[model samples]
Structure formats: C-alpha cells, structure tokens
Target: MSNDFFSTSNRIKSTPFTSRNNMAGVKKYSVYNNTLIPTVFRSLKSDYFHLIKHVQIWDVCCQKVIEVRGNNALSLMKYLFCRDFSKIVSGKSYYAPIVNFEGGLLNDPVVFCVEKDHFLISLSDSDLFNWVSAINHTKEFYADVNETDILTIAIQGPKSEKLISKIFGEEIKFLKYFNFKKFFFNKESLIISKTGFSKQSGYEILLTNPNNGILLWDLIMEKGKEFNIKVGCPNMIERVENNLLSYGNEMTNKDTPYDCGLGKFCNLETEYEYIGKSSLLKQKQVGFEKDIFKIHFNYEFDDQPIFFNNLPVFKKGIEIGKATSIVWSPKYSKYIGFLIASKKIMNNLNDYYILDKGKFEVSEIL
Candidate 1:
C-alpha cells in the first residue's frame, strides 16, 4: 500500500462513530461530502466476503440530509428533480437525479417523504444545500432549506434483517423496502429506513442526535455479535457488479442525467415543471449520445483496480470512451467496472481494450 497525505482540519469532519472505527482498526479512509468515510477495515477481499455473508455497520454520516420543510416544500422539490412526486407517498423514498437549468447533474439524492409537507433530501457527495437555499432565496417559496445534524448509519448484508430485528423488533423487519418508520432507542425517537446504497438487504438509521452515535453503534455491535458483524464501508467490487453508480465517481456536473442513464427516472412530459425540465426535454428530443456501462474483463487482474477518474478505453487502438469505476471482483473472479462510451460503442456491448492492453466486454447495467 502507498501512503497518501490526507490532512485533518475543521473543514473535514469526522462522524461520531470515528472512535469506534479507530477501535476496529480501520485501515483507510476516503473523503466524501467533506467527511471521513472508512474505505477498509480488514483486507478488501475479506471485507467483501463478510459483507456478502454476514452484516456490516457502516458510518454513512457522509450521506448528508438536506431537510425541506414548510408549505412550499413540495414546490421546491418539484423544481429540483424530475421525479413525479405524486407517486412518492408519505413514508416512502424515491431516488431522483437533481439537475441544474442546463440539465447537468448536480446530485443524485434519495428524497424521503417524511410527512405531507416535510421531506429530506439524502444527498450524495455534492453541495445540494447551496442550490436549494439559492432557489428559496430567489423565489418567494415558504420552504426552509437547511442541513440537519442527523447522522446516518447503515446495517447491511444478508443477516442485516435478523440483526436489526433483534434490537428494533420483528415488526421492523417487515417494513417494506424504501419505507421508513420512527423508532425509539433509549427513549429518543429516530428514523430507520429500509434503504441503502448497497444491493444487500439493509436499513439506514437516520439518527437525530450525534450523542447517540456511539451508543447505537455499541448496541448494534453487541446484539450483532451472533451474526459476526463487521465494520465496513461500501465495497467497490460488490457495487460495480450490482451496477450501483456513485455520484462523483460515475457522474458529475459535467454530465447530464441522460448521460448517466437516469433518463428512465425523468418524466419530461409531466404536467409539473422542474429545474432543467426544458433542458432535459430538449436533450430527450435530441437523445443521449453518451452513456454509462458495466463491463467485465476477459482475464483476471493480479492487482485490484482503483480508478479515481476516467481511464481511457480504446477500440482498435483508438480512444472511444473512458471508465469511471473499476474493481476486481472475487465473487465473479473477473475485473468489473463502469465506463462512459459514445452511443456507437455503447449500443454495441462488445469487446474493447483498456490501457491499450486488456481485453474486456461491456454491457448495459443488468
């Protein structure tokens, strides 16, 4: 492993569970949303297998919540993303891409409808608060936009439901996917939702008090002892295989929602108007010229692949696209990742070369 300099300061915040992570011997961290996110604890392959077979408690406080409350909260939401809010009933969450006026992706957040008028935008790694605040300031909307102190913790894996049920009761295990319910822990009410970034069966606890962070972590760890719970963050290999897209990793402000394969989430012809609706409609008419793909290598890689940015992909010695995310999957025994390619190459999911050497095959997100 190579040592990279990462400084700590007021700007880079640590979650309340940082100490616990330290105790767990967290090996590495990556910054997300100006917060320290644990990238590894044990070895990568070990952590990946643990996450697949057992349970993991992840300090996902970096998944910040931008709360929108008041009469015009729905109006602000309507103007922010392209999702049809009418379909998002209370106690449910909807994944939507927040775009700017030019149809460029600002952030892809999971909007949670907490109540009739109150909603929480659980954002990815982006400054969504500023955008919402600016919108509220310019318009005479009755919505209040502010970042909440609520820290998010995720319990994920095959055994997550059993472990959560041991503490929160069996009723919580029955909570439908994408639904949330308020539960009390030590007499403090906190929200737990059946939503997570991982494809594994899991729940994200939206903790209200930062003080309860370690307390909750301890309780879960204690109860989850039987299930062999591990302290792990999001696994790159698993996410790539599942085709989960990261915000800054897969798509950014430079790309539109259509470019990131988010067109299905957009309803351009809806009666409701949102920010970038016009741009999205125009882009829809023009159609997407570039998009993301999930690719698999023909041969195994001796070393795990980590891509911070795009890696040039070539076809017949000519650069055609760039890969955003890469990982060597132990489950599939293959190198798998996501890449952006032109419509011509993207339409034909076939053999290609990366780094002008390796043979690979690409496919749409399955």
Candidate 2:
C-alpha cells in the first residue's frame, strides 16, 4: 500500500477527491498511474473484514481510462490481442489482456464499449496510453486516442448493492456484470459499471467531471451510513485469497497472456489481425512452460509468514517458480499466495521448497 505522506508532483499525482481519502483516515497509499491511491484506510486486517461485511468507497481514480473515437476504434481494439472484440457491444465491459508483438503482456484492462465507435480502455498500473497512441500515430486506422480526464470510484463489498441502491435506486439490479449505464446524479453524468477488482460484488462509478468527485463521494458516504460503509482500499489479504491479480505484483511485461493463465480469453484465429497474433499462435502450438497457480503455505495459525518480497520455489534444487503474491488469509487461517510456476517442474510429491528457506505446501489455483 502507501508509505503515508502524499505530496503531489508532476509524476506522482493526486486525485480531486484525495482530500476525502486523507480525511477518512487513510493510513497507507500506493502510487498508481502517478496518482496517490488509498491502499489502506484503517488497517489491512480490520479494513478487510469491514469490506466483506459492509460497504466501502474506494478512490480508484488511478485506474485511468484511454478514450478511442472514430470508425476505426473497433479496428484498433482488434489489434489488442488475447480477446475478440468483434462481438463486444455497447454498454459492456470486457476483460481484455493487451499484449505486445512478442506475445508479452502489456496491460490487462477492461475495455468499455461506451457507444458504437466510441470506447474506453481502463488501464492497470502501466503507461499503456503512449503505446496505444503510438500504434494509431499514423492515423492509418483513423482512430483518435486520448486519455480522458475522468476519475473512477468503486463501491465494493457484499452490501455494495444496498449502498448503491440508496442513491442510484433499485434499477441498478438490472445492470448485469461488466455492464455500464449512464446515470445523472445532481445533474452530473456518471458511468456506473458492475465491476471491481475485489472478489466482493461491487460497482465502479466513472466520473467525467473531476469537480463532482467529492460531491458524489459525500453523497455515497451519507447514504452508506446505514450500511456501515467505510472508506476502504483494495486489501492485499483479501485479494491474495481471492486470487485477484495485481498487474505489477502478479505479472509484468516479461510474462505472456498464457503465462498469466489468460489463454481462455485468447481467441486466436487468422480472421483478426492483432499485435501478438503470430507469437500467440506459435505459443499455442508449442505450448507454454510457465503458468500461474494458487499456493497454500504452511498453515499454522501462528505461522504469520510476513516476507514482503517474493520467495522462490524449487523442487529438488531445480527452480520451478516463485510466489508472486503472499498473505495470511484470516478467513482460511492459513498462509496463501499465487505462484507462477513452470508446469514441467511442478510434477513432484511433497518436495517443494521456498528455495533454501524450508519445505512448504503448494496448491494450484482453481
């Protein structure tokens, strides 16, 4: 999460409603897209339980959106591999894995079809806007790419529906998962989507007017008082248990879509030409050696393994993989993590070790 003090700079930015986060007792912060995001409101352990039981408003403005306009917007989207965007219609959000020419992962973002020929690509941690802009630089596709001034706020948790209904009304029930609709609140239009990074069901509200951010946040907070709603951020423990992958933590530019276990979304065919079509096709035929898995570490309740960095995994002295994300799952009363391991090296019986540290139990992500 955060190291605390947030001083806005050119590179490290602050959102419009960042003051609200600080006022809400935000304890930690993480810089995403150059914006200071509240990673922890109270404490990870306490905030996590509250998030699952009640409701939380998250300042996710760091999750920026890249707007693409014109007739070739769909064509540009087609160039984004590991997903078929031809069938994607307006009002839907697709979890598309953006890949490069070498089939290496770029950014796994949700592409929102706002309207026909108008789309928004919500980014993760990376500066994918330049890459995307460069792709359409020649204007050959006739697609204009620009970063939107919009900011995002997420209402996540089990009680998220009830909290959102208090302001948005009961009609929100009709909004399906990965679906978004324009709603005007206090005369300000907001695109609300039934999607979030948490395992808990939630909605992400896209604020076009940055000035209206605090206004909207305050409105939700007031309505959320009944639901015991608290200001929150993405909990590492909850995400680890839920296997909700974070870009820089779970993956990087070196990893491919297949390595990330995103092959199911890769609809590779000769019909659609994308950046990584050839390499993905080759990997499809040759197969991937490394893949991601969920690991169950030593499960003693007192075994609070707090290694902040990744621990390498080995089988009989042969390096197999490493635990990319690790946490103590309070709900499970055990240590769990997402391991990026090689398939060939994973065939063993109780021989896995965290390098020279010690022996540990390994489990695959289901």
Candidate 3:
C-alpha cells in the first residue's frame, strides 16, 4: 500500500481511483481525523429528526476484512474462539470475542460465513492479520490462511429497502439481519449483507473493486434523490442508546467479554474445546467483580470538549468506578453514559455519584 493512496481535500471531489481491477473514477472526501470520519458522515442529516430518515451511504473502507480459507479452517476457528461456529450456516454471521488463554479480549470481530469451508473476519482498528498469524504459529494446526484488502459500503435508513429492491429486487427484503446474499453488478460479484453498526435497518455491500465502490455510491445517492436521501455514517446517539458497544470505547484488551456484558455470546455448550474456555468458565463460577452498566448522569456538559471528572469519584475517597462515553440525547432530553464499576458499588445505586466536572447523583441505571 502507498501513502499517496490516501489524500486530504477540503471538499468531496471525484477523482481517478484504482481498485483490484483498474482505474475507475470515484468520489472521495477528505476528513480531519481519519478515525472520526465514519461518525462525521453519519452526523449530517437532511430531515428534521436526527435519524437519517430517507437514505444514506458510506465508504467504510477503513474497516478491513481478513479471509481464512483452505482445509482445517473450521478447526483453526474452533481453536481460536469460544463461539460455536459449527452451528453457523453459510451466508450467515456470528459475533464473538477472540480471546487469549487468560480470557482477555484480543479483538471483537464479526465472523462471516461465506461458505461451509471458508470464512471472512471483519476487524475494527486492530490488526487481525497479526492475530491470525499468531494462531498459525501453533504448528499443530493445519490450515491455509490469507488476508485480503476489501472495501465496503453501508446503505442504511428506512428507504433502504426500496432502494435495494430496485437493484436486487424484492428478494433482498427477506434477507434477515446478519444474513447475506450475493449479486452481480457490472458482471462482477458482490456480497450484500443486512447488517450495520446502527440499530436501524440497513444493508452493507462488499466490493473487491474500488471503482465499483464509487459507482455504487453515486448510484445509490442518485436513486435515493426521491427518498430525500442523505450521505452520512452510523448514528452515535442511536448506537449508544441501543447499547451497541464500540471496540476501544466500551471494551478493551484489559476487559473480558463477560466483564463487557457479552458473556451470553460466549458459548460453553460446545463439546469442542477453545482457547479461553477455561478462564471464562472459572470467571463464570467465581463471578466478576465489575460489570458494564448504563448510567444516566444529572449534569450539563459540552459534547465537543471530552468531559472527564475533575476529582476521582470515590466512596469516602476510595475510588469505585469511572465513566466512559457520555452523550446528551436530544430525543430523550437527558444525559447518558456507560460505566464499569465495582459490583458492590452498583448494588448501592443510590450512593453512586458521577463526578462529571462536578458531583451529580446517578439518576437511573439500565
């Protein structure tokens, strides 16, 4: 990959771009912080409601996909995860946490079932390729794995059904969440899945060619004109309210899936053994000291300036917990944030006060 592949611009512009095939002109936007580009795109609204009511498209190339193929792929996956992939059917998806032996979450990636024998792992910010390599280092495993650079476009909103129907027809409407269907555009095969980060209904198109990315983007925007379509990224307010956790924000390497409130997804029912099963089983029996919880704060704070408590929130100067992501919900007309605190502290909810710039009592917990 070349550094010149990415360039900065003040406005969205159409330029000659190269994909797996050849040069195809596509429109690109130059964003400030590359990490925030996804959120920024979703913030732009064409309707009165914060929701992207009509339609919206995203060039989420930043989220890379790694494909694992060849014999023993399933076995390798079985060794790497606690999720029972054996039950996953082709064209479906499963969400699981890839953990180490000590039960630390390495990366929370979505495992997509492209075929009974092959799979694609979608990663957020972590380098999944390195993780895959580390798994392969155990010579006892027999599998061929390769990582591929892929680009994806997310088409979301209520009108998404109608717009996608025009291209793929009414069959697409039946595609269940976490399910995918394959279609051809310009004689090239593309996979579209009924999944996205937003709680709202949507579809994501995976394309190998970058040129096709621009064409699909333009086509959706053009066709979406009647639907009052807009271009944007995933809705932050909607995601948080729905309890959809992001990678680095809600969970990290230091946190186990159980601690992050994803313990239900951890499957201990399987006869086949996995890497972190022992630790997870032990944690389950012993119970966790802290658990992720949704907390509503009673305070007014600016959204831009990342707010942090001035004094360490404590029970008689003994720290109990700290706040994570916080946002003011215009719809709910209240302040909401996520917190990881001692189970003892949570038991006494009335005593817990969030020190958001100043001390404020916790209004409620969900």
Predicted candidate 3 versus true structure: per-residue lDDT over 266-359, tens digit per residue = 8977888888888888887888767887877666544443233222355545666666666655555565667776677678767656463345
**After superposition, candidate 3 runs with Cα above 4 Å error:** 1-36, 41-52, 300-317, 357-359
> After superposing candidate 2, which stretches have Cα over 4 Å from the reference?
1-7, 299-307, 359-366
lDDT of each: 0.82, 0.82, 0.68
- Candidate 2, position 11, lDDT: 78
Better of 1 and 2 by TM-score: 2
Clashing pairs in 1: none
Candidate 2 — worst ten consecutive residues by lDDT sum?
A: 299-308
lDDT of 1: 0.82
Q: How well is each residue in 194-232 modelled by candidate 2, as lDDT tens digits?
A: 999898999999988766788889988998999998989
Best by TM-score: 2
Steric collisions counted per model: 0, 2, 3
Tens digits of per-residue lDDT for model 1, 1-366 = 112426788888888898788889888988899988888888777888899899999999999899999998888888788887866689998889988899889998998999868999998999889889998879778588888998999999999999999999989967999999999998999999998978988999998877777889999999999999988999876788788899988888878888878878888877877899988777778777778777666444455454334566777677776777777677766667777667776554445455434445443233
Please tell me which model should have the higher lDDT, number 1 or number 3.
1
TM-score of 3: 0.85
Task: List the candidates' TM-scores in order.
Answer: 0.93, 0.94, 0.85
